[model samples]
Target: MSVSEKATIICSKCSAETDFVAWKSITTDTDPIFKEKVRSGELYQCICPKCGNVTIIEYDTLYSEVDKDLTIYFVTNKDSYEKAMELLKSDEANSEEEQSGVFRVVTTRAEFREKLLIADAGYDDRAIEILKFITATHVKEVQKIKFDAALFDMQNGKYGFRFFETGKAGIFIPMVEDMYNQVVVDFSPKYPTEEKDNLEVNLNWVINIVKGNNNSFI
Candidate 1:
């Protein structure tokens, strides 16, 4: 279920036009190796035959994990990104029949990677994002420091997170099970228990909570 298009791309280094297979959609169930290629960052890379230079293609692709019930559509082009947003907004009342699993709309390459990693690890990416938001709020309240980014990491059979501070590139603050469990416990009430068919609907709830609308979020 990996969809691709053949295109004649001009090599930036040698200016030689060569045919390349550009992947537009990838399904982990069918093309398993593609997931590894994504992790290695070689799937979107084209090696020029003439100059031997690597050219990175920035195009939109849908990354789907059927086993994990996740689908993330990534668009980098401005027009496509805006159109994707508009489509998602129009499908606000997205029917259960129209969905197979967690259908998330993403606009960046980093987000696409993060969501794919989380789904491959058998965890819910939306829930993890909510947990990160709560933990970031606590970090700011307690340590008086800004938490910029975080990614789920497993170390020594334990589920943890690696955090980055504002303006820091490689700064990581590792968290243990106790901290993660605390966030889960705190955010439990905000979870949408009724939407068992679509658990990610609660992501909007978490976003509203982040926007300072505690009572009206739900």
Candidate 2:
């Protein structure tokens, strides 16, 4: 059986302390290992009931040497996140640009396939354009992408896509290395810093995935 613990968190927006059950291992339909990482302390996130915000709780300080008590350092803006979520939920009814927020809308699977066919076609432009389209249509969905899997793991928690093998529903958009353009430097203060490290990594991985050199889904 998996063990769990109760943790208390204070809402950054409301300043109300709420209690949460921190699971040691939460088994789900997709990605069984996700819970293992959380149990191992490799990942940390929580949800606030008062404001209904799913916050990324950081246990250790960014540059702190001493081990301090784990605290709720970051509380995500639930308003925007939830708005983007609505767009994703209504993807089929919405246009390509609207679905862009939930998933990348390529012209066609052949377009992605052609890139794979080319000798030196890179994913930099394609990925950026797809992400940008999604951002422009549903700005909130861009932020909620990080928490979608965790929040909906039980129902349809598959990350981006189920697999890249072969099927219809369009090509499974692989996880790009630097998929994130902005990094949350501090959640308590609700500050964001532009960083390109994630984007660089995403490009490298997308290239490999398209070439079939790597099978690890982003």
Candidate 3:
């Protein structure tokens, strides 16, 4: 079920307060429009009626696709993450069925969107994250700059990643399927099943995994 409420938002440009629908939790099965908005990168936007100015608002929300067993918590900071965990625990307590599958926490909106795309494309997110880490590391070494990579799309057996905050922004690098396939074969067996909700599986997670396992996906 999708949970939402009417909230007043003060426009950044106009300083005008307006009523907006704020979503606390979104279920893709029941809220396709909201899901689409999130995909189109318009979910956190507020338009001022007086000045017609658009403001981007970022908040914590739970994104779920129940049938697919994918739940993601989009949180900006530690306080939001704690609050989201409390809500998730309460919901789990109230529910009769046991929850399973990929439950994750993403800090940024871009990461949230990338996770959705990964899930929709039927790719294992763990594998994709490993691939992203490898690509980002190579790029950092070659370009002498740090970059955050996200899964853009896959075509002709090549996975494309868009690097954020690079020297030249919006750069796409094509990673062949062989890299992803090798990661899955090498690391998938060692990957533990997610028993805890909101497991954060980002680049940091991958780095830790690589550090712990001597021969794991270097």
Candidate 4:
């Protein structure tokens, strides 16, 4: 189900108010046009009628793909996460049916897009985040800057990334195939599960394992 409503947006360039449609939930299976807009990131994008300024109107939205077996609650604020956690911990959360596949909570437009890209690439988003963490931290010359975006090239088996420096986006860095493969191989074994129900994984869950923090999440 795709839910939308008309809303007003202020233009950054002219400080003029404009009206646009904002989506509250996006189900990719049936509504592909909106889905394409999500991929292209134009669903709530608004152009100022007065000054031609472009901006995106962001709000809380649930992104789901039943065929892909993925559900991500994209929350814009901390309160939403707390509320979502409460829902996840309810009796419905204990149902065997609900526990069948990946369930996650993500914040930020970038992470929301990353989830879609990762699923499209037939790769795990958590694994890719770990790779991002490594790239942003351990790598030497690359570590000198912070990357704002990462795009995976499944065709070439490479990661295409860009960074924001002085309001400028850096070009794609050289592909690191070895590191990607190494992370996929090395990270999976950290928590091995024979059961099919346990296929979904995330960085927070991994962090819990490393920190010996035992908290229940599905």
Mind giving the per-residue lDDT tens digits that candidate 1 earns over 96-161?
355556777666566667776677666656567776665656666776766666666555665545
Backbone clashes, candidate 4: 0
Clashing pairs in 1: none
Model 1 spans > 4 angstroms off: 91-93, 96-98, 138-148, 153-168, 192-205, 212-218
2 against 3, candidate with superior TM-score? 3
lDDT of each: 0.66, 0.33, 0.77, 0.64
Can you give the lDDT of residue 43 in candidate 2? 47
Clash totals for all candidate models: 0, 7, 0, 0
> Which regions of candidate 3 are displaced past 4 Å?
83-97, 142-158, 166-170
Give lDDT tens digits, candidate 4, residues 4-36: 788888777778998888788878787867667
What is candidate 3's CA lDDT for residue 17? 95
In lDDT terms, which candidate is top?
3
**Tens-place lDDT digits, model 3, residues 43-65:** 78888999999878787788888
Q: Is candidate 1 or candidate 2 better by lDDT?
A: 1
Model 4 deviation from native, Cα RMSD in Å: 5.6
Find the candidate with the highest TM-score and give its number. Answer: 3
Ranking by TM-score: 3, 1, 4, 2
Cα shift from native, residue 213, model 2 (Å)? 11
